[model samples]
Target: MKTRFWLSHLRRVSPMIGLAMMVLAACAAPGREAPTTPPTPNPTLTVSGGGALQPSPVPPTAAFPAATPTLPPPPGGFGSPACENPYLPVRLGATWDYQLIHETTDTFTRSVIEVTADGFVDQDEFAAGAVRQGRWQCQDGNLIYLTPGPVAGSVFAGEMQTDVTLESNEGFYHPADLRPGQTWHQKTVFRGQSTLEGEIVVETRTEVNYACRAEDFETITVPAGTFDALRVTCEVHFTTSVAEGMTFEIEEQSTQWLARGVGMVKSVGQTEGAPPYTIELLSYRLP
Candidate 1:
């Protein structure tokens, strides 16, 4: 009876649970999608002294003291003006600090280092002492994660050390050309291998499916400030298979608030049988 009850509950909440986990994982290391054809590299702009182009900083507006509750999908749907993606600041030297609350409270930071001839590089540091060095690029007005690898001397989770290599660039945000009710899909696969105490090797394959939509607009207040933001909802399905024939599946729902020029100010994720998790921007420095 207990197994039957849990199964029934999972059937109803799988999508939401999957999305919650996906949002957290993706934020840490955005994966790559499988593309049928190779895409041409976008033109790179050079800055003064023949350096990489830098993003211009945008000033923040007045803050709203009152926190607005989440609202239903907006009527008539809204699209970004000029089809510009605002979720990624993309400026060199820009940084954002976030406070994540899950089983425990932790802080994380993401900083943009170099805007290369092909893409940009970011350094991600987790409170648990792990760090990820990655690259990102813009294509079709969407921000994509190109390649992500762990830095040497960076601390890793658990007793295993793992590395992530991108097979293809995966879209992380599509604020440009996004309209209310517009749905998009993404799939990513990652392979992880770890060596145990002796010489035993364990391989794990992770696959994630995301179905996201531009749902509405809302006012969210964080430690940084309050702003009117675009709300995006996603349903995610995740599967992990181990070399030992053990497979785990997860489902969740996630919501992110992207403020213009500020990026992600807040995200809420929830899964069944577990407490909800949240990440909120504490502060940020642009350019």
Candidate 2:
């Protein structure tokens, strides 16, 4: 049941989805559940504020406040106007179709359409079965996610109900323009609550930190078409805490290719203890 439930939520692909999704899956743990493994394993995580991994058998008193960026924001205020981003043109009625291919033969298709002034609407006809949208704000060229779209996977079966809310958010989704070797940072906090038969059963808090850098530009081809794209790499760190004093930590690495006037064309990523996956653009239309 856990595997099926996690996979269902994992398929709700986001436009900038990466390690954040992995952390959300882990957030499924009941507020009192304990970590089954060491917070840090092999391949020491280099994410800032990650510190060292504690030994197994996490104590009930462990407390690790979420980490923030150690370095200052890259010159230019970390972001620019939303409309100024050539790589992610947010135009009304614009639509993008994508295909997510797992390491196995499993595949899923999702779409983002009906661009609004703040953000776009993401939909997965099969997995989510409903339209989900998030809010974004562009201030002086800085684009920020006010609130992520409603996570449909929280709709549990049976009498179990889950509600996930954003506690706080800081940082920009992407810079107005991609400059070679440019770097940025972001941090987000989420609160998850679970109920059994209308009774609150568990609650969890998750903090996600991101460190990203733009590599270089290259011409890439996908089912949609071919275009010059910029390669960006990011390292994500997750820290989840339960009221019972259990804390869980993990890391993920991902890369994305953004094309001018086309938005994200391809994405490849892997969580600390999971297989790799790829998301590619199948088709897109702009007004």
Candidate 3:
């Protein structure tokens, strides 16, 4: 019944409570809902401002503007006193309920997640194929197992992390990377307005790591409750591979700031018998 109505099915492994999964909640890629294909029109990525994409057959008068209802701040933590994000200023182009997750251990074991959002105009042009009609974002479950399109898969490459800017991308906050503590990882991507050509990639990975990394303020319980988080920063370009006379090339990339609610990103211990490349967080959402 819709894959047992997964929300990661509470992270699986329920053989009548027999126990077997050890660890396996990772269900992003739009909660893994791929396979149904056939919508095609303006879906290069998704955006309906004026860049292009939402062209053919999406003209039902193209209407979508009635989602302004966010009144949840009155709690010492919302608008002032160092915290205030009721999904603020993000109502630019309409199209909500966005979700993303990416847990890389290599080869799509899980963690891709997807929900979709849209229209914040300045520019929006996707050029992909199959799935369109006012589609600022209409992904009906991307699901995951890696190998969706590209990489010798005939170009569709699975792993969507929307917000690929040309103009007016998702929200804001750039600067992410660092996976031992003080965690950080934001990888949003978008651009689809819709004659169809192709280009889709949604893979979000926000990490805080181990015991919540000793805290700066990261609470995100959610069922519709508890929300306190941080980490919105990034910038770290690299090129490591020097094993020639090693005085200590050591390879590393850091410029992190991920302290809000944390997800994705599972490992980074490297040194002291190096083995942990962990990278695992099967679920996440607070936006």
Best by lDDT: 2
Candidate 1 TM-score over all chains jointly: 0.62
The lDDT per prediction is 0.51, 0.52, 0.21
| Candidate 3 local lDDT, 6-89, one digit each (tens) | 111121111111011110112113555322232232222343574332212321111122442232332222112111222222
TM-score of each: 0.62, 0.64, 0.17
Question: With candidate 2 superimposed using the best TM-score fit, by how many Å does residue 68's alpha carbon deviate from the native?
Answer: 27
Ranking by TM-score: 2, 1, 3
Lowest summed lDDT window (length 10), candidate 2: 53-62
Evaluate residue 127 in candidate 3 and report its C-alpha lDDT on the 0 to 100 scale: 18
Q: Report the C-alpha lDDT of model 2 over 118-197, residue by residue, as the tens digit.
A: 34433444333323344454533444543322221122233343455555556665765566667776666665555545
lDDT of 1 by residue, 1-287 (tens): 00000111111122222232233233334362222222232322224564423222221111222443434332221122222355666667879998878656778797887764445667767666645456555444555443321111111123333333333223343434445566676554554433333222344455666668877678899999997887888776666655444576766688888876777899888654456778899999875
Count clashing pairs, candidate 3: 60
lDDT: the better of candidates 2 and 3: 2
Which of the two candidates, 1 or 3, achieves a greater lDDT against the reference?
A: 1
Q: In candidate 1, which residue pairs clash? A: 16-252, 16-253, 17-251, 17-252, 18-251, 18-252, 19-252
